[model samples]
Target: MTPRNLLAAGLFCGLAVACANPQAELAAHEHYETTGGSMKLALIPPAEQDDDGRYLNLDPEGSHGSIATRLGFFGRRILTPFRAGAGAAEHTTEAQVSIEAADSVQWVGHSTLLVSMHGLHFLTDPIWSNTPSPTPPFGPSRFVPPGLALQDLPYIDFILVSHNHYDHLDVPTLKKLAKQFPDTPFVVPKDNAALLNKHGVNNTIELNWGEQTQIGNLTISCLPAQHWSKRGIGDTRQALWSSWSVTSPNKRFYFGGDSAYFSGYKLIGDALGPFDLVALPIGAYSPRDMMQGSHMNPEEAIKAALDLRATRVLPIHYGTFDLSDEPLDEPLARFETALQTMTNNLSALILKIGERHAF
Candidate 1:
């Protein structure tokens, strides 16, 4: 089948599955009705059209190319039962290492980070599921297991969610985390409070951009990110997206939660300069013509690091899932090339999937 045909089939399948699931359909309608707010979603111009005059939606942009075709290729190559066994083994190894560490941060695959500081543990965008789709049966499945399993994580004092996208906000993962750390507080974007509430996540605090809250001795401030958010197709931009500046008495860290290159980085730098570390997304961007507006390529990711003036940069959001056209290693390779071209004093600390870094 052609790429276009595959894309259509995937969409049709997803839509049909959504419609058949009464709970999903009801959730979609109820979410839109309550969270649509006064923001005129209808007034916003229709998505820009491509040459074919079809509205170019950002969520599944370039759906026909890398997303549909390459994913299909991998989906067929990997055997489900074997993959499950391997995933379990990998998860066990990483969890043992993470739990054994005395004072270090573990990259729990993708944007998930577990920071251990001042006797407190924090998890960022913790998605332990094999796939980041709304339904377990479809969408971007993890090629490998999460570095740390949900139950294996230490007593998490707090969880930070940047936005409402499935990749960033997996409801099942959150439900599991909530169950494990029953009283642990959750920090998320202001408008997304309802979604968590619906899932029985009561210990959630919503913050708009520039707002700060304290968890133990750590002071976390939500900073601006050049990204958009939505859980369903029609509820785009209903919630805000943001990076976060987490400061403790001894250290300051920045987590750039998936953003396009934008002036917001400079603003963040001006306000919160000389961070001890910055965790930035460095993948899932391809066919720049379509992705440049919402996702940053490697070079742009470097620029964001420079703008933030971080002492050490840790790249995330790559190497775990195949979300774009670029080769799996392209983002890191491009990052190295960009580093050589830079005259500024910027450095990066790239971690292996199960690696731990002491800050």
Candidate 2:
């Protein structure tokens, strides 16, 4: 189906497939909701629970994983090579990343990127643990190390965390960063301040969609994305999910933390257009029926980039961990295929896990 068709179908099915949430359950937090009570959801008017325009509507009746599917994903992981070695070979060093420009980006690993703009160094969804899970060294092992070690970073002015997911918001890393950079600000979604505080990480600023804050010379606006937030049970949807637009004096940039394909991209672009560069996720989309709601495949990522009117793109969220059944390289392969089919020449900057690009 065309992207538009898929979106329409999604709205139809997604609206019908409602997740349950009693008012009492969300009494404490007005910003939280959930669909089918699985992944917590938030409603943004004009793009709220009813706004089907660009929402990814996975079928309510689609094939959801049973015990068998869970086992199957595990089996596939064990059997598939998933480019574990090639990703390991791409490890970048701090020396290589020191070649800086006024604006530059380095793909540290999955969903973790170092964006240097406005004369300030910022990291998006920073995670340097050996895995995406809380119990690092015990969960998915990290074959690819970060391009720049925590110590290697020149100095982080602030950190932008998309959600509370382990991959995106590693509290251990946060604690370390907080201890090391005592003055660095940690920007996150609402209701997430306590989480950081628990790790002894202070200076956190929480934002809701449409809220903007000034950090140094740049203006950072917290925008919505089609996604959910949770570190464990009962905390789902308590914290908001978001995309961010960081506008500097001369350049505007975007960081798509983690999300499924949604119309918010167009809305974001409409509201904040012509991004000099956008860091978008492009992996973990196998079993589309299940992941469609929160994860975007390569094609979907491509569409998202176009929707955001992004001038250049850096694809992340793959090659770090084998989160899904698809091969690690499959996203790029599919991205190539989808890009070829596009009539408009799109400038997608594909970087090695540890590589750097100056914009």
Candidate 3:
């Protein structure tokens, strides 16, 4: 099927599922009752027009024209069935395997990182799928294949999930990892535990903003993010979204799962200041009028880095999928330009799909 038709069908199917599943409705209500705060059921908001005479306050426009426009530009350059050949493998570095006092951080592509510090191993937003869609057959497929397969990862002690977006919280990848490492613990936002639990991920814990949990010596705090969550149309705001602050003895890492520019950054910085490293999103922002409230542009990301007081920033959420209108390399180029002004304060790092950085 054409990309347009596929998107249309997917939207239709998603809406259908959202409407038919009474369990989902009940689950959403129960979730809200359990954790009372500003609640959003799905990531995308209901279609609405802003005072600026544009459709800025709405869920993503999941239409044939929208899909075709993005695909027509990006489809030719990005690969499908995303298999990294020998050349891609040749660049892969053998990350320090020991879970203790390791010096390296491996990029498994997208937001997934294999981080080893203070004698522990952790995976963040692990997406091993060709596409970030709800279904494997269609959606925004990866532009570059994953550097390492699921089986290739070291024994992961903890899996950190930021939210329930398909790209960040993939069911298939989580299921495979669960089977491979049954004892691995999953740390996610409070409302999102059900997503993991539904997949038989029993060893999971949910936390609210400022709530911290420990696995071994690693202490992970669920921090607030100015973002939304939803897997399908009707289920909007059913889950909570967050960024994570992971602290080890020797190093501290801030993983910005996905967020827009918001005042929360200052709060995070005040609470967990002087982060050693930060992983922040720098992509999927287009037509700023529409995306600015949810996704951050490169300049905004740089500001977030500054606010977080991170020593170094690693840019993720780009170079992996064609999720927005900007060119594949636009984010990095813009980030580079933005860094020029800050001189000493702003430094950014891009992890070549499978590349590893020793921190």
Candidate 4:
């Protein structure tokens, strides 16, 4: 079958499975109705929650997108020829191993990153699968392979997941990591533990906004992000989504899971400014009316970096999977253009899929 046909077939199968699960659909609708104004959620500060226990975005008005609108976008997108761009120029395994002692960041494709700092290694929002979907061939296929093979990674002290999005929280990759490094902690936002547990990944530390945990010398904090969550038909917003902050004694780093432009960045900067480095998403933002509440465009990402008061900025969430309407290379192109016009001396860290940069 052609690629388009395969995608259509896979989507049909997935829909069929979802339809077969009547209880899940009913639960979803029930949750939505009960959530009415406030919601029931956990691991969050009371201030961030509603009277009924549902989690709320910093922007009360924030929304993922209308279902009809998204369906329209998907319909239009599927009809067009899929264009998998020339993949990123990945580096070698030896290069990855060489970054052990020095503080470094390696882009492993999409939001997957290998960050080593202060004697410990960290993997952020890891997804090594060719497709970021439970139902394969139905979702966007990875245009390039990961920068470093899973076996090439140094000892990972912590695996941080920012949200429940398929691209950020891939089960296959997490399962492999669980097997490879059984002792490492899998940190995630509140209410996400069950999913990992269901997949046999029992070593998880879940947190909510304003919550944190310590591993070795590092302090990992779960912060807010303007985004929504949904892994199945009716699981929308049932789990918390967040950005993350990892701080050692001398250096600090921020990994933005996925978020739209919001005033919360300024709040975060005021509370935890002067981050040494920040990784922000610069893709999957188009049809502004629909995406403005979820993903940030390139310029907004740059502004987020400045808001975080980051000394160095790394662009991510692009050039791997075709998740939105923008051209694959457009994010970086616009990022570079925005950087050239910046008044601050914020350094830009650009890397190929497998390339590593030491700080």
By summed lDDT, the worst window of 10 consecutive residues in model 2 runs over 18-27
Residue-level lDDT of model 1, residues 113-136, one tens digit each, is 988766678888888877666544
lDDT of 2 by residue, 1-359 (tens): 45554333323222111100011111111233423332122223322332432222222223434656544554444333333545332565535535454578888888888888767778898888775554333334466777777887767777899877777888778888888777778888767789998878878887777666667767777777777665654554566668888888899899998888887788788777788888888887776655677778888888998988988777888777656656667888778788779637468788877788888
Off by over 4 Å in 4: 1-47, 51-53, 63-68, 77-81, 86-97
Off by over 4 Å in 1: 1-103
Better of 3 and 4 by lDDT: 4
Number of the top TM-score candidate: 4
Q: Write the per-residue lDDT of candidate 4 for residues 237-337, one digit (tens) a residue.
A: 78888998888888989999898888778777765668999999988887566778888989999999998898989999888876777777888998999
Please list all clashing residue pairs in model 4, or write none if there are none: 39-52, 39-53, 39-54, 40-52, 40-53, 40-54, 41-53, 147-354
Q: Which run of 10 residues does model 1 get worst, by summed lDDT?
A: 19-28
Give every collision pair in model 1: none
Better of 2 and 4 by lDDT: 4
lDDT tens string, model 3, 1-359?
66775664355222211111111111111222223444322222222334532322123432223455434434432333343221221225455344343556778887888887665678999989876766555556566778887777777778899878778888888999899888777888766777788889877887766666766666777777776666775666566678888787788899998878777787678767789889999886774544566778898999999999988899888777656556667887888888887558756666776777767
Instruction: Give lDDT per model, in order.
Output: 0.66, 0.68, 0.68, 0.75
For model 2 the local lDDT of residue 340 reads 73
TM-scores, one per candidate: 0.75, 0.79, 0.76, 0.84
